[model samples]
Target chain A: MLPLSVPFIATAVLSVLGYVVARKRALSVAGGDIRTLTSLPHQHGLNTALSTLLPPLAVMMVWAIGARIAARSDVALVPENPTMVYIILIGLAVTGFVLSLLRISTSFRARTASEGWIMGLLIFASTIAVLTTVGIVLSMVSETLNFFGQYDFRDFFFSTTWSPNFRGDSDLGIIPLIWGTLYISFIALVFAVPVGLFAAVYLSEYAGPRLRSVAKPLIEILAGIPTIVYGLFALVTVGPLLRDYFAEPMGLGQSASSVMTAGLVMGIMLIPFVSSLSDDIINAVPQAMRDGSLGLGATKSETIRKVVVPAALPGIVGAVLLAASRAIGETMIVVLGAGAAARLSLNPFEAMTTVTVKIVSQLTGDTDFGSPETLVAFALGLTLFVITLGLNVMALFIVRRYREQYE
Target chain B: MTDYKISAKGVQVYYGDNHAIKDVDVQIEDKTVTAFIGPSGCGKSTFLRTLNRMNDTIDICRVEGDIRIDGEDIYDPAVDPVQLRAKVGMVFQKPNPFPKSIYDNVAYGPKIHGLARNKSDLDEIVEKSLRKAALWNEAKDRLDAPGTGLSGGQQQRLCIARAIATAPEVLLMDEPCSALDPIATAQVEELIDELRQSYSVVIVTHSMQQAARVSQKTAFFHLGNLVEYGETDKIFTNPEDPRTESYISGRIG
Candidate 1:
């Protein structure tokens, strides 16, 4: 059996015990009437659970780190087969933690301990989640810093060449990847925004009840389809069709794996995202506004073009931004459809690679942690995170402003 | 020939299977204020909407028989509802100003109909329409402010201004005073009376006193049918129909 960490096991035990005690105390205080308590007994129990678990979890983490460091120091004295010795020490430490948990569980009244124990456990659980995110950010930042130490920051930012193989000399600049990402996303947006907005306008304003019921669900089903399925379709169906029909006949390119191929597939993936959001924002435009416009002799389309869209402009912008973010972060379609050769070109017929593709390539299969190649993935990840976060923040701001205007 | 601006004959309206308005016939004279007074769901608003074809917006709503503005059959296949509405404008029950500047709100219809050739002409029409609605003096300084920023009464007047900017021959008002305070209602009522000097006005009102105050002619609807329609003085004091007397007395609405 895989041994569990001692602190995690102890936290679970203390939390349960603390909860029982807190519940009993709260119920007794309420004269055994559960409803008489200010809050639900479960909330009181949770408060106690969080208090109990947090303190011991913090102590355990510090102890575990110190123990590992001391073990490494002791292994340094042995001078012979340090790696094997370190692995053995880690195994011993894990076993000791499991044994400690087993001993703690066997004790009596363990299910009715202090209320602080339950509160501690809850707090510890939340901290674990928050700390995990912080840990990921720190790890990515540190590795990215290491990558920047080797490659010039200016070259990474501005240079448009990206051929990164572990030969004696390899160029690894980020601009080509950024360009590919932006180009595919731009193509996707161009295809999505108008079609989606029109569909949204039609569905919200023009469609009768029967048509709306059928069309709205059908559009949502587009979003429900798996991204990998889209990837496969792009690879097998669209790729060959483009090659035979357009590329070969026009003499645009020799190969099927092209930016246009991936972009078209990505655009199809983003249609429902744009449509659904645009539908919601359009629906949010008050009925009174439509009535007012229509009442004034404006036809339905004219009303939509003049008043409805303008009223919902900020919301539409927010929807497009959200869709743009989704398009940028899309990975599988680009991975399968767009060939991984990060060449900066305006031609959609040419093959391109994105930051996501590079990150995937760097991390997959056998990866050497010490190498600059693997570390570069961390930098790409950080960049992807920042880009998506900025897009989301801007979308939120626009949506909020739109709502404030109406309210 | 009768100096009528709008005429309806055997007009029946249905929302899905439910008949909202029964067979109703009414004639509105040129440059006169006509009031439709009835209880809620008695189809006063529905009948008012039929004049401008505003009911076309509702997918479930269906209108049968004839409604004409200036002798032109509004429901005819060749007759564009947009153009018909351009000639016979409407103001809704609630104050629904577009989320636009006051000038733009008034200029919207004129711009859509291409009534103005240039900016100065559009400005002149806007100022004239606003003045006619009796809102120009209050809103003169803030023509650029959002129409929605105005008070409830001012917003209704702004809507009236918006309607008049198109220079429509007839204006249909479905409870223009419903959302306003007494002072605002009085102002709108006064404006409605003054509007009779130029445009034929059809107003749907819930208050008997308001119909008496603003309208020259009043039509009383009961259930979904027009029970009585005549001069405002005759309907209020000595009505021919028993339903009209009961409605006016507040016995049955």
Candidate 2:
């Protein structure tokens, strides 16, 4: 890993050089009358500085990655594993590129030169981001295809069996895992939707300005609390509470690690997410609708129920879908709260497993590279990615349609 | 007069420290159009909103004294403002149409009050309301389309239709033609004339010409006080107040 000092130094040097060169060019273009320029001279300076720094930094990243790969192969051949040497070399490459950018900046200008280089660098940076996403998808797809070649596709999808042991005999059907995930998520949604939506409506429509000021920040603070903290809260506090109150009383399985426990905790974790999103969309509904309803002699609550809520329906649907996606992809709460048993059962008090939990289990600790158990995590990840992507696309379409109605 | 539909007795309104409406009293005659003409900040609209209890929506506003609708005190604690508003509807300065189908927009009030027993009753109410607003022919084919998709004039008429669907005994219009073009204004003025035959109509306007053309009685307000109130022809031709004369002659707004 490159020391963090490099990029900062490079950026600082490039910024100064960019300022000087941009000023000189601007002054010359305006026949020494600086006031004639349309924009501030500093904006031009920023533009030039960005151009100088971006290209070299990109090239340095590629060079460092290539060096590491080459070193990995060479280290494999050597008697001693030269991991430190590879790291040092990669670090040097990054430092050198950063220093080079620092030394040569936009101040070092040729009068004949155009801004083609800057544009190219910007395009190159953006393409790298797109290429990285595509690369991840491609890598996941290829690995998943390899896993399917060993396991039947129908069995992987439809079969309820999912015992992926590294021992000679192993079954890795994903149905039970998918079922557990959907069940837990469904429970979470049931808890989240009403409470979140009610809180949102209260905050947006009914709360006085002072109460809203206090309540909104308090809710946002829930969002700021890390998921890991929520997981621990679920595991230590809520889990036992549920086992005592719900599971034991109902004559269900008396375990703290139940789907019900995890789901309820996860719902609490997602309250801020749902409330914040729903609040924004509800606020976006024009005040005119409220006034119109009120003018027609409707009570405030009646106006909200009849006019505001209906107008904000599409956006609220979008918010719910997004919350559903968050609940599905959440890993820490389920891992810490729900037990590691992959069973398809209707009983909420029973221990259940989710896809994210299985992914963590499969990846962590030592394991044989060629085993199907190891590869299943990648397949699970690919499926999760696809599901979230589909939901987001649908949400975007709905939100766009809702916005077009008013605009 | 015994024919008066609404009577205000020493009604006063205050916004925080600013007294928005001074001690003012007026009686609106039944089944006639009464126009209140004044410049901006003259409290013409404020006085009009008092009849339907619309000012109660504002948090800091306080209304003092009595306002009676058909000889019943509307401000009585036992009386519900919702029911009062249903009987006395209002149209705002700008055209505010609900984001619903044109038919649904007109049908909303009737549906809320349970006035229609069936689909046919609702259809009848919608048709009659639209026809009364003089918007039926233009909007007859597109009843299912969104109400906001109409032209400005049509949207204003749609709001008028929505107001009339509740079968209000009195209609309060706050500068109904201010946002509309001249032709739309003319259409609305004609509709106002037609409407006065059935329901008491009160309009707050800045146009003296509109007051002359449509109203049976005209009240001129200046700086939150009623300066003159009489028959429209007499107020326009021979006013007793100097402020009214200055305003009518365009010497003062």
Candidate 3:
């Protein structure tokens, strides 16, 4: 750790010393008159510090990547000595600091020089974020391609069965998983949308300030709870309640774990997402719109229903779509409440499992990476990613269009 | 007072701890344009909202005094604010058309009040209201277009049309021309003059010249008090309260 941190600490200390020493040199160059200089002393100091840090950082980054790749390929990178690498890095920092200090004359545009380095740093930071997302998608794509190479693509997509045995000649179809995903998500949305929207309306339009201030944060607290806890809730309380009261009495099914259990629990999990976002969107509808409606003799409810809600409809739809994507991607609640049985059935009380649940079950515990079952998780992930991506884009489009209409 | 179209006596308005409107009394006549001219924060808009009980919507706002429309106490427990607002319509400082088609914007008031018996009747009411508002010619072709797609001036007229579609007896306008350009302002002023032939039009304006041009009666407010009330010409020309004179001559706001 000391050997690793040594170069970084040296670079930092040198940059600080460069800043103070360069500022003094700049003042001396201007004959102690700041007004005679093209840039302020602080700007000259910043230029020196950035120049001291940037070159060594870039070299270190390149060296680290080279070392990683070389290790993977069973070869040592150039500049094999660790001390030699540290020497090169610290030398570069010293050279850059001295060169910038000498260049900080009375006519030097130090501000622009510092600004360019800062902009480059910002660009590097943003590029890391973008690269991470791109890297994830690329990895998924590679594994999915490997999956398709071994398993017949036609059977994986078109066949309804999803039985994966460790022995050969096992079926690895995705249709039933996709069906379960959609069915559960649909039931969740059906149960959540109206209840959430009505809650949003009550919070935004009818609830008094005291009630709103108390109730809003309490509802948002649901969003803060972990999905695993909600899974427990589904397992312990709602699943048994539904099975004993409704499913057994109606002769639908006797199983405690069913699609309805997971769907209803997922709906409970999603209520805060829908209601909170819808509340904000409804609140954003200008008070002037409500006043216009009310001034024309429309009742408060009438004003909300006819004018305010219509104006906020696009944003609410966007919110619902976002919640739908979340429901589709959910894993833990379905794992506990809906037993892992991939089946395509219209009866919601039947045991079922979603794509996310299967992906977890496929990849967890002892699993060889060479097998189709293991790689299929990546395929399921990529499919779910694409679906959610499409939904997010559509949601953004609607929300943006709504913003333009009002603003 | 009974003969007046609308009457207010000793009206006081408060928003939480802030006294927005002090003791004030004024009577508005039927089929006449009455202008309330004052500087900003003088409570002209607040008083206008009280005529239709629009202040009831503000949770912190409280109104005290006698305000009557057509010899009926509008603040009475038996008088529903929704029904009272239908009888006494209002146009806002900024034109706020419902985010709907032009035809739907005008039809909303009549639809909720159940004034139209059928489609043709609703169409006639919309057409008549648009024509009355002087928006018929420009908006006729694009009745299906969004009301927000119109220019600022056309949106104001659309609001006026929406207000009068309920066939209200009084129209309260809070600085209707403040957001319009000069040409649009002139058109709205001309439309206001025509609207006075049917409904009692009460306008609150910051511009004294607009008050003189469009109103038959003028009431000047200063520091939440009614300084003077009489004919528009007398209020503008003759000797009156010093504050009213200062406001008119641009010596003081």
Candidate 4:
């Protein structure tokens, strides 16, 4: 078949040609009195261009997807002759161009017609966004179902041990990974929530204009640093530092890569997520509220703690929950700082592995697609998806309820 | 009790080099309704804020000279603004009730001041303040409802109740009736008249008629200067200054 660029270039050239031809046709039909036409010349041109590209692009996309599906089947890779598909695609483009060229008339409202097509394009773009999420969930669910078919659902979910082996009958219990995900996320939140909240309160309330302007973006710069960089910081710096100074000396595990190390680094990474959003929420509690409290004999700190903070509590809870969801989905920092040991231990300083790390490990490298090990990644992914989805919904509900309180 | 509840001597207020309130003097008397009448931007509100040190909140605002309330200098470094504010209560134009129960809104000041040693005492203070604000009968049944749930007039009265819960020696109302309807304005005027018996009530009003109706003594301020200060009857009938007469007759603002 012709390369993808061939059809793209052909469509672009044809669209430009269609624009010029249709504009000239419209002007001529208007008898050089542009006001006589129902729609302007530019509208006629845009309508022709949209019509010119639509047919060929749609045909090419459909043919590409059909060929991909056909190639996946137990048949030859050519999939019903790629040459015929290219010819038909080009044929449709030419037919669309010729039809549009004949349709540009003086009385026609090309503006309204083209606007309808643009609106359709916008709706289609939004549909693609929603369909992508649906597609991801479907793919994961199918694989997870296959995984449960091969392995007992109870053992996969409820069993405490997680031992994946090349020998087929691996103890694929998700409990250990689930525990590690929660434990690390808990520690991350415990470290993050208070520090982030205090920073938000101080910045939004106490910091003067000049100080706030300088400090706010500087704190947000921490968020701009990618999580992968945080992983490296965790790996090379924080892990060894914690092991030598805190963990090993306190009779905890001697491993450089432990749950404590990963949790602390991840917590630092999540500070901006909490503080920026909480700052906005705190700032939204009206200036009148602060004045009322202060006018009633309450000091600045008392006003903030008793009045402003209480008014902003619902939004702060929502922000904390969103941060919690992010902490659960975090992968890079855990893989580097938390060692790959799926042990069910009470100690936080011991090496542990999370669901995300195991999902990456099981999916990477050469492995049979039919094996339960590879399919378990989908199960882990679906569980994580469900958890984060639950958290997001709760946050949205709380924020919505908070809005109605003031409005 | 002293004849003058609050006295300002050559008070000058500057907001970042812009002289908002020029050097002026006025004496507000005890157990009387004193009204500051002026056009917009005439520094009536700024001068009222100086009494309670509310001007301290604005970083650019600077108050010079001395303002004595009940024989004590409020701006002295030793005086805590919080304690002074409790002694001198303020009600704003907009009804800003805390997003809490009506009872809690009134009890807020008393609780912070440790005025009530027990829950029943706090409850008594809230009731008495609401009663003084003429909101007791209406709000007594639903004291647990959010203060913000009240109507605009009721909310303004709730704020007044909240302000008086601390049992202040002086109460300052900055255009308290400006946002109310005609009926609500009448009700608040009557409340202000009653408030004069217990606390020295200082009100800043834009309406000349309101000053004539509610004030015992009226101070007409023009362009940051006290144009005329006398009994409300004489100020309305025959003002001393031309600017005061023009402002009263609706000539120049």
The DockQ of each candidate is 0.55, 0.54, 0.76, 0.63
CA lDDT of each candidate? 0.82, 0.83, 0.92, 0.89
Q: Which candidate, 2 or 3, would have the higher lDDT against the true structure? A: 3
Q: Which numbered prediction scores highest in DockQ against the true structure?
A: 3
Q: What is the lDDT of residue B224 in candidate 4?
A: 91
What tens-digit string does per-residue lDDT give for candidate 4 at A1-407? Answer: 44777767888898899889889999999999999999999899888888878767766655565565455565554447657766776777788788877887877989998897677667657766885797699778988999999989999889999999967779999999999999999999999999999999999888899999999999999999988999999999999999899988998978899899899999998899999999999999988888888888889998998899888989999999999999999999998889888989989888898999999999899998899988999999999999999999999999888774542
Best by TM-score: 3
Model 4 Cα displacement at B42 (Å)? 2.0
Winner on TM-score between 1 and 2 is: 2
Query: Model 3, range A273-293, lDDT digits (tens) per residue?
Result: 999999999999999999999
Error of 4 at B188 (Å): 2.5
Please give each candidate's TM-score. Answer: 0.84, 0.87, 0.94, 0.92
Over B102-125, each residue of candidate 3 has an lDDT whose tens digit, in order, gives 999999999999999999999999
Could you tell me how far off, in angstroms, the CA of residue A271 lies in candidate 4 after the best superposition? 0.7
Candidate 1 per-residue C-alpha lDDT over B1-253 given as tens digits, one digit per residue, 9 for 90 to 100: 6668888999999999999899999888998999999988899988888887888878789999888777888899999989888888889888889888999999999999899999999999999999999999999999999998899999999999999999888899988888889999999988988998988999999999999998899999888999999999999999998888988999997
Native contacts recovered by candidate 1, as a share?
0.70
Runs of candidate 3 exceeding 4 Å displacement: A1-41, A55-94
- The full ranking of all candidates by TM-score, starting with the best, is 3, 4, 2, 1
Residue A377 error, candidate 2, Å? 0.9
